[model samples]
Target: GEREQVDFRTSHRRKDGTSYPVEVHLQYLQGENRRVFLAIVLDLTERVATERELQEAQRTLSTLLTNLPGMVYRCQNDQNWTMEFVSPSCQNLTGFSHEQFVETRQISYGETVMLQEDRQRVWQNVQEALKNRQPFQLSYRIRTAEGAVKWVWEQGCGIFSATGEVVRIEGYVVDITQQRALEDQLRKTERLAELGTLASGMAHEIGTPMNVILGRAELLMRKAPDERTRRGLETIVTQVERITKIMNQLLSFARKRPAERQGVNLEVVMLDVLDVLQERLGKQQIEVVKTVSPQLPKVWADPDHMNQVFLNLILNACQAMSDGGTLSLALHPIDDTVELIVQDSGSGIPEEQLSKIFDPFFSTKAVGEGTGLGLTVVHGILQEHQGAIRVTSVPGQGATFIVSLPIYSEEVRHEA
Candidate 1:
């Protein structure tokens, strides 16, 4: 038998639109007597293309999971701490890497959870689930790579082998930092509000007796023969009056009053407030600069409540400027509302603590120096008047508070 020259070729295209070079193989079946020629065509293009696409998808998914704000992980069921898989997010959540903890066994995942006494409770739950072949659910804090810690909730079922033996544990973890912080703040605020209510009740009950004592002391001072006795009685009477004022402020903040609205001239109210605090301002050397418009229209508010508002604000301004600075009071018309501005050249409020100034029982002053209800009472009073107040300050420069009230006209009231 003699063989003849033969040539064959084929073409194939990959998934990525790449063409593969053609190749052919020739073979003969020796068992058959005649020349039985066989040809085989090899096309590896499709398989190669599929593998490349799979790799690209995996890379994209890995990048996404790694940059996620939560932790993703996979662990084996063994007590020896074998890791089937761990995401790069483990570094952000638990201060360990996927490779370091999985392949090299450089860290223990369970040990890094939390060091508190409650950690034992978590371990006990995990042990019971593993022994009973049940799903595992746990939440705990974990130390992270940058020395930061975060809360994570893990819930996952065990993967079983063909024989029903547990094989692996896989789950996701989320950063609950913001949720926990809100919860803490809510608890604190609730406590403070409760304390404010109790303090208000106590102040009301004690105020009557304190006033009686103060009146008695004043009467006794006038009649005391010895100068030292008279001086001591005067001091006691002054302290009792101060305490009574603080209690009134607390009660105002804690309880709401049915507003007795009437035509109120803001300029007249400001003048009265200045008169009440004139002696105190003089003692503190706080200069009052009033720029109230004489022709300003009236506002609808309770006269007494409005007077208290001005007193609280002006007194606070005078107290703030301990080094003797200007206390500016200005009233101007803005659209349908009148704006009252009280500014002081004192040490300004800190930015971080400004938002809490209206919160009950929150104060920057030392204990006994303040009841922390001054601003809260002011806020409540303004709220009753259907007005709004805002504050702007810069540390070391000063603070400005603005109060806006709707203008009241005789025509509007008569029409109503």
Candidate 2:
């Protein structure tokens, strides 16, 4: 059978023996004298090349978005900020799959991930930025699907139509939790350095007077014949001695000596400190519990500094338990570092006071009973040795302090 018209696509060969794609069309034309067929060929080389280039660009874009360190999202300007498209990094950034974010199956980015207190602030900020047609940057905390809190930094702008109407919001979000922590630590270190300078100056100014008062009080006690007068002199001597002790602590805070670093056996140092406190522990009826891991590695630290560190901590534990309690101590290796855990079963610190415990002149003891520099000095010493200490406690339960120091290594020698 003959068809009125025929159309098909095929490859055409040139005289150079090179082939390119072509679209072919055939039409039949009949005349009274003769019958003839007409054919037309269209070259598709440019069209085919352009299609391939477009596909490659799309692939490149997809790869770049997938490997970004943070999530890339385009969402509606609605209350939930309902996502229209989200990058695969959503799992790592928000702990949710991209599919879930796109579908919003059971979670909404604004409602579920963002903190309740921050929801309104974020909404208002975005709206303000959109109103002005400008990009906005935000730093806020979000609770992840795992129930862990994290800090995030986001920068975004609105998608506007040709008529200048807002259509969508697109942004990138990255984790800043670690960066925020480092900044906070830097601030604390700066504050302590300033306070230490002030304390040192005051200590020097008061040191001579304090010593003179102690000497006068002792001389007066020796000269007094009446029992009441002698008792009064004794009280003066004791009070002067206490002030002297505080002055020495202030000087220590001001003049933190560089550590004489060496490989130290921390267990031996801890045991020696405990032995020195044994009598005090006995008097207070405080039971001691010790757990030391066998074959523990040595730590790169100063032996004397380690001794002072243990002494201050253990003595503090003893003071907390006036009615007698348990003092649990443990030592073990954690990865490349050694950890010492000190826990006390005494009148534990209040929750609100935990953060301030390491601050200078911050203490839980009654007036005239403490100088409040014990933990502050300990914190300074640990920082010098490239170590860290953290405390956990519940009011009336107990307090546990965890200290970590780097394990002895050849690199530590050069670094120290």
Candidate 3:
């Protein structure tokens, strides 16, 4: 019994007939005239159970991050905002792997990920929030890996030590690009409605004076006694007609066009617009590229309104390019909507003016070049058809306008 000592774990049965895991230490010693044995037992059930629970929790968190629609990140508050930890979904958000940002000194969050124009503002807001111990929330755009622009929302807070020193920050970044775009479209529609109301009142006020001018000009033309006077009167008549046409366009922009809800082919509408622009294109040496997918589903819109949408956009694209350039028209289906993408190789719009392009009476053209209502009319028509439009451009490179309309479904066809 004095030979050795052994230590191991086993399930032990208690006097109450309950068993649990245990670690056992047993030893035997030889005294002067007698042998002694000793044993020590330690319970391992609680410790093993705790470890299992911890592992389960870790697995659950991992599952959540994998399926999360957004990215969860933790990073330093340094100049580059060096990332510390990032979830796997970060790839979908930034097109970079988690390892790419974690402890990355080469390209931290701000310099490489955020848009250059928005960096300073983002820094300011985040710093202000950090100093005030409040969460920072910002909506900004990022340049995607594919060179497309994306709008993202970031909400984060500073991690502080016990001494009130901020050493790191953590946050969630979600791709709110689509949501932000829809908000912008809603705001523009609201503004268009407001402008329409104002235009209706103004049109009423302008119609009477316009009629007086037309009547007086006609009377003067009929009574012209000399060739010079006749030419002057005839010029007045032509100018009056031009003014009337301008007024009609304003009214068209102001009044809502009722949707006929027919199965409308936007590609055919685009072809018609191209047909009308054929002569102008020839004069300007402009080439047209049409990439409309054949047999696409029709949209629930009025054909006339659809034609107006395409015509205005096409004419605008044509006018923007003073010299010969490529004009591209592309059509495709996006989920439940049809998207018509029109692009031009003309001088693109300035960034500052992008937000105001759809505004009423806004134009970048020279005097007598445009009535400044073409785009407004286009926007109004799209709104009437429950459609949407968005534009992207880089100054001097060119512009692309995307128009999306609800696709007509079989249910609607049967109803019609």
Top of the candidates by TM-score: 2
Writing each residue's lDDT as its tens digit, candidate 1 over 112-203 gives 55645556676678667867878788777766767676777777666778987777777777778778878866875576567669767798
Task: Give lDDT tens digits, candidate 3, residues 147-256.
Answer: 66789988999999999999899999899988987898788778767766777888868878888888998898889889899899888878777787677777785766
**Top-scoring candidate (lDDT):** 2
Q: Report model 1's TM-score to 2 decimal places.
A: 0.54
| Candidate 1: stretches off by over 4 Å | 1-204, 254-256, 293-295, 366-368, 409-416
TM-score each candidate.
Answer: 0.54, 0.81, 0.73
Whole-model lDDT per candidate: 0.78, 0.89, 0.85
Off by over 4 Å in 2: 1-9, 24-40, 161-165, 213-250, 293-298, 319-322, 332-337, 347-372, 392-397, 406-416
Provide the global lDDT of candidate 3 against the true structure. Answer: 0.85
Q: Report residue 248 deviation for candidate 1 (angstroms).
A: 1.4
Better of 2 and 3 by TM-score: 2
| lDDT string, candidate 2, 221-261, tens digits | 99999999999999998898888877766676677677888
Give per-residue lDDT, candidate 2, residue 400: 95
Instruction: Looking at model 2, report the run of 10 residues with the lowest lDDT sum.
Output: 248-257
Q: How far off is model 3, as Cα RMSD? A: 5.1
Of 1 and 2, the candidate ahead on TM-score is 2
